[model samples]
Target chain A: MSNRDRIEVLFWGIGGQGLVLASIILAEAVGVYEGKNVVQSQAYTAIVRGGTSKANVIVSEEKEILFPQVLSPDILVAFSQEAYNANKGKLKPDTKIIYDSDMVKIEDNVPFKLYGIPFFKIAREELGIPFAGNVVALGAFSAVTGIVKLSSLERALLSKVREEYHEINRKALERGFELAEKLN
Target chain B: MSKNVRLMQGNEALVEAAIMAGVRFFAGYPITPSSEIAEGFSKKLPRVGGKFIQMEDEIASMAATIGASIAGVKSVTATSGPGFSLKQENLGFGIMAEVPCLVVNVQRMGPSTGRPTKPSQGDIMQTRWGTHGDHPIVVLYPTTVPEVFKYTIEAINISERLRTPVIFLMDETLGHMREKVLLPEPDEIKVVNRKFPKVGKEDYLPYKPADDDVPVIAPFGKGYRYHITGLHHNYKGYPTTQPEEVEELTKRLLRKVERVLDDIFILNTYMYDDAEYVLYAYGITARIAKEAVNILREEGLKIGLLNPITIWPFHEDKIEGLLGGKKKVFVVELNSGQMKGEIERIYPRKDVIGINKLNAELINPYEIADHVREGLR
Candidate 1:
């Protein structure tokens, strides 16, 4: 494997979108699969439902993580238009943007590369899953960033998710990986 | 060396260190900048046969922690500004009752919930005097993730050793920042458990001052019957109305911490030996001051940084030694002038300059360098 020092990830969504959970899963993946160090931070407001929350995770092969806030992200995933608009500028020059095209509108004129995935649609249509969009996003992130293996991401999800909803969520994550591979 | 270094945030490291320190009781409410501390501990506590309770409010949470501490368990609770305001009553109770507990105030922008989730170090004075009357408390301010881990363990040790409440005064910046931390092996680190009085119930005086003014505590249900209260009490644990009893009790309570100030105090000196300018800072401000010191050193300026991990009873002797014969001392903090006043009180004649920032953002290193440059002119 190529040895890059750190992988910075920015996961953005509304309060109810499980953005913090997605960041936690990513942190667990780095810790479990690659045995690398990970730092996860989230920003949210007092209002519970409609306010935007962003979880920024930084993974490094060998370094003590400091400054929990990500100054720049190599990978940016947005589940809402507001999240996209608020955080897209924080991406590094050559960073990748993955958004749920069903719920987000990405400007075509934007200079950086964009991967507009129908994450919500895939969760609902392909896997018949409704609340598994965050897991699907994580699957897509694992596939694109190649920071952690797919098996490890699946293990982390299984460990954290409720047992009752595990099956469809696992299917949703697999579908997300399939979709990302085909697009890439 | 374990070689088990991990990149963790300050909040995460606090939890990690607590686990390693055998902390089994955590009761806290979710308040910004400090909620992660609860979240982190909540998840890890169960894995280690510990309990994490999210109480209805900060007041109840702090009370619960004290209850657990008196029940012979290592306990802690974390909070931000407003929640800290709510916890002051119970904190005073802990001081009076001589409870071994840790209270972490992850400070945020605040007069009263000014900024729930933003960073500020304005609570230095509040940590010292928010509670009513005179009481001694050990307060340690950490600057980095590793220090957060180290000092948190130290806070627990001191609280247990001194039989008093200890404050891990964390700011939002340090609490939220991520950094690499080296975890010590299980056998390598020194751990201090609570000292239990060996005497039988008939002869025991709960408030009888032991050596070093630290009394051996007997847990509530440990079969040792003893009276406990927040009132001014005698060595025999009964409330007192006598003037001499109150005076002696009050003086010992304060002296327990004041006597050990030299042993528990610490400050970091960066290139201060032959410096012409001294920048004094703590918490997040210390990080920025170090950066400023480096930049000034690169420019061949005679500058140094004195970053204190122990904020309370500010390290008077060390400050004097470092500032020997220097005419200029710059004190930077996120608050208007909390610690600066302490520095001035310590060295009345020294040219103590205040580089104040209350903008809710951390003071920049460039500002310190500029102040030093201007002072030179």
Candidate 2:
């Protein structure tokens, strides 16, 4: 797992689910706060919402990030059933698959390590904000992978979101971290 | 002082650089992959006393940009594949009228309206000869986010200096990718403004040539009343049909850029000094080629990269020098052998292998590495 210096992460969900924003914050955490090289790119349908969307981010300790697209991602965070189904062919035997258990139901038995968290449920019931699911997924992913520090993620989120909405997101992130820690 | 390090996309960098380069007006239509430029300008331009207008379509946007430039304002417009096609007629008009403006084409996959979100380098030839007839234009391509910012300013500078419309060519990959960029301080960069006429109103020729064959552009309605048209024009900017007048104007227009090719052409070479194999690419493909060269070198292959920063007015001499003593040169691009055609013209006898990818996906580094290994074997 540590053979390569670069780490690729893919965030997949329907549009308007904040997957793109999550990818941007995650990239900012690693690239800006952690001072590593990063490239973040996204693909989505022409529709504004309820459309398949995916964001690919590559974080490298190397001086340069050559390819911006993630052909094979080390970590896949799925927020929708459609996203999981769409990316099933890209799954490798050792790849880590993280999905929202409340949103996606997996029928196929995959060889990779699969972890499910109720991201939407926690965001709505625990954090009182339904849109904070993306931040919760970020925290859970960080806790599971240990790729980027939670402090760095917090700082990146603070910088990205509006000043008025910082406290709610902070709570959402902390709840995510706690949930991931309990699961691990 | 603001911190120089900031996370920016290629489109954002272009807007920031244009603003810093004293661009006062932006007119553009929103299109996929390239729409961020218009969005960025809409917010940033107003703060700096500049104006941004989302025209009804690409044609109006290009015409309005030319109109702004004629009023002594540094103007810019951006678009993707189909919009670029719609813009070519007015782009040619800007060339003939010698209107200094910048046209940014963040290319997407297309012959017509191919792919809105996908990246392609298919517009290389379109930019060079898209408009009708014989005319000279400058086109700049940048591979990195930092180069996107730098070359955008360079595009504005060249346009103003040469009094010609400059095409700032970008791919959808670069346009959408986000990266960390250390923007230079405002005073750190060289900003060139257009040379306005200094003569009194009695002796002003709107189409008169300066020492470098580029005419000094005087803004319209500024007490310098002169005719400006797309037709063959004489020294006073009046329409001309005589053989000498038309011949001289055409020659001077082409000569202005041809004579200063050395000043405009920019290229970057990596590991070429002791390399046996060279990979020639531009834009996003060059970034991938750099990695491929690195991986092959670690495996002990003498591979190098020749990245063309200026795509138009092809760097023939520099490319020839880099190809010296190299056994094979792989021309890597996102289009089906667009740049490879130019390279073949330069080195007719050499083994110029073209690794072309046209499926709207980036050429991966592993693919390039494997090709190098195969070529060596």
Candidate 3:
């Protein structure tokens, strides 16, 4: 859909990567805290772990979200090489492309603003939690695009999981922000 | 909308609203996409002093819902396509017996089991005619999580007030998608219980019509003994081969809701006040059609959309008045022209066209915009 007025973000990976959870955090960050209209739509098959899953979050300042699916996302985060390749076509010329440097092998000639960040590596090494990689990517994502306040994303992220992981998640998020700042 | 905001799935919204609307008993078979509703009730019902039962199969679930309702409690049952099919026989029984209960069907793409996680509007006709014979049914199709919350209450209220079964239809996308909703306290709204016979047990005729064409049948176990049967029954609740009583029972069963269609029907129209063409859609398809309307509006095309939240007994005259001068009514659905035929039944046959997709994927707005552009040319 041609939702040029709204900010659309797509996070895609295998089924068990917490991509849907990341999108939910982003949606609540914008919709609840920031007081904007937002919708998060997901597509998945029957597969539990390896199947393809994509979550799209669309934010609007004025209009209610009628179309939730993101066909052309302004910010596309691919956590796997397969996801990146499958969704790279028909992107906006100025679309921000963020891919996991650890998992995605990319060609040199890409059209959009591309950033290859090893989100998984940073989360695993800095926080000793590989599963927290999605939160780190959200941190880097907030730093790069300012689609939502880092504090808003942090609050939304904390509410989604148990109490024990919050501290490591905070550090992981801060590390992602610090790393992205240095590169940009 | 209260300040008590929470993020929940569409199925959870329905369950919560059903409870708030005084649905105290649930009998259901859990299935994909719709399992969350059954799970929610299994957890929440006991806290409200309600009952939740997981039936052996869908048919038993349907029968148990009707049974629970007969015992003077508001009851509900939820399922998917396969379970919905299994529930059809008792659904007719509910219609025949004038039982008041809610049936939540979170439709997945299907002939049989089909794609468990994929969404579809394929059950549009099946829901209307799933039960055999001439039966009147009310179906509510809600497009969003919050809408599901609002309509679930309406469905229960309708069912109890009219003494008929109301079908709540949601697709897989709407069933699984999570969104923030402002929940109102149950005390803010007046919850209704079905009317009971005020006369002595000996004076009450089980199937006799009250002033509203609905029988003020007392619930079972209240000493107002009544027989509920699937066979065509007379006012005394006894089966009869007499043609007059059979015809009278059949007509009154339908007449209760048929006479009040305008009061109960809910149609949502957007950008249609000055439009020259209309898009007809519901469920998630209507959501995308609204986006297509925006796109077409930006291009200076005079197009709009009509989404009916009330899905059964299509109100042709009301819709015809709204689409009086429109060039065409595009029936956008995730099926092959079920509702297109329904709309065509209103206008001249060729004035309506079906914009359908059956790939088990949602139809995109750009595809709809392109089709409108082509149709106009």
Candidate 4:
């Protein structure tokens, strides 16, 4: 399992939670910054907010990658309980599952590692940014997977984020990384 | 020297390729799975002093492109499932009027707006039959992102040279998947513009075919004062209901595409020298079918693949000859048995089977492998 050459990741959340933004940042980091081949794809119905949304990103260091969806995700980042339930079946034996503890309750006897971070709580309380939770999850993913370097991730964020929200979201990412390192 | 290859989605590559092909006018409506083409053109066209218009609907979008093409501008329109359905009447109009333009359909799952943002190769037959008429059409299917760029350039050239509307038949997977593509510099590619008639205004007959069966097309505003209409017309471009003239005009319309059939037909065959079984596939499903056949070959089954690039005016005889002594031919597609019927019609004596899916997802290579294995059993 460890011999895998690509880090397949899926980000699941409701609309307006920056699900697509997070995946785009990761794809740009891996593809443009780290010089890895990447594909970032999103799924949604025709409607807009509060709808079920998913962003699938594949980062491969070697070999050409096709098909954007990760049949078995190495890392699953979920923001809501429904998001976690929707993608639980896509985890591999050694997969890593990360969800917001404030929003989702985990089931036991899973075949993979699990980490519950209070992503929403950290963003709203510590950072005073209500919607930066997705960026915080990106930080946590960088800390655990290490497939994407923090510098590359920051560069991607800085390039895409608007000037008004850049500083606060940057702080949120730092806090998520710091908290992620202390988790078992 | 070969330049550095930049990764591009099929939509992005199509835009860049169109610009390089000297396409100056684009009219389209934005729809999922194909909106990027309009966006790419909208952004870059202004930089190059070209034009892109977001029309109110697909019919007007397609019509505007044809109008631009007739006025001596290279033009194109892009759309997906429902939009493709809407543009059919105008597409037939382009056919009857002998208008040269390109129409690209980035296929999504659908009978009617089925899945807006999902990938499906369900538009194969639509490209051929969407328009209601006996008109001849050229449809090219690209399997990979880079080919999307390559075939798009080819589609425009064919439209201009053949003086007919050409379809760049792509699907949601290739339309959305980004990959490395080496965009050709302006000097490295061949671009074809419609052949303008040098004949004086009095002697020029608009529909007269050249020795090669491709008619010399004169731009409407280029002092080539001639009438054009959807009703059957003679070489003088005037509508006529006479039986003899109608017979000649219809034969010429069909023969124009048939004469260049060899030049337009394209397919890729793998391991078919003496294989017992052949898999016929196209668009995205064909890529997975290739993988499935490769695995089956290793597992000691004699299997091969025939992937078509020129979908319409299909190289039927090539397929018929290949399946000459084969035990079975499996046609794989994302829709339920669309291209399989074409395959069966071509190879009447061979046992034909269809492995199809309508789930708005691409059929996996493993699923194709399972089907091939069962067929062997």
Top candidate, metric DockQ: 3
Least accurate stretch of 10 residues (summed lDDT) in model 3 chain B?
Answer: B1-10
Question: Candidate 3 has what TM-score?
Answer: 0.96
Arrange candidates by lDDT, highest first: which order? 2, 3, 4, 1
* DockQ winner between candidates 3 and 4: 3
Candidate 2 lDDT by residue in tens digits, B1-377:
12577778999999999999999899999998899999999999999999999999999999999999999999999999899999999999999999999999999999888987888999999999999999997899999898899999999999999999999999888998898887888899999998878999988887889899989878987899899999999999899999999999999989999999999998888888898888999999998899888888888889899998988888688777768778888999888888888888778644888888889888888898887777667
Highest TM-score model number: 3
**Model 2 lDDT, residue B357, Cα:** 88
> Model 4 off-target regions past 4 Å?
A1-7, A124-128, A162-178, A182-184, B1-9, B241-244, B270-275, B348-350
lDDT of 2 at A28: 84
- Ranked by DockQ from best down, the candidates are 3, 2, 4, 1
Interface RMSD of 4: 5.0
Q: In candidate 4, what are the lDDT values of residues A1-184, reduced to their tens digit?
A: 2235667888887888887888888887777777787877777466478877788888889745544457778888888889778777766888888788888888888777887899888898888888889888888888878888888788789877789878887887887788888885
Interface RMSD of each: 7.3, 3.7, 2.6, 5.0
Would you list the clashing residue pairs of candidate 4?
B7-B179, B7-B180
Instruction: Quantify all predictions' global Cα lDDT against the true fold.
Output: 0.82, 0.88, 0.87, 0.83
lDDT of 1 at A113: 67
Candidate 1, residues B1-377, lDDT tens digits: the string is 12386656788899999888878999999988888899999999999999999999999999999999999989999999999999999999999999999999999998997987778888999988999998786789988888999999988998888888999988877887665578889898889998888898889888988889888879999888888889988887789999999999889988988888887887788888888888998887786787788778888988888888888866667677767777688888888878878878767644888888888866666667888788778
**Candidate 2 steric clashes:** 0
Task: Summarize candidate 3's per-residue lDDT along A38-82 as a digit string, tens digits.
Answer: 887787566578788788888887777877677788999899888
Q: How much DockQ does model 2 earn?
A: 0.50
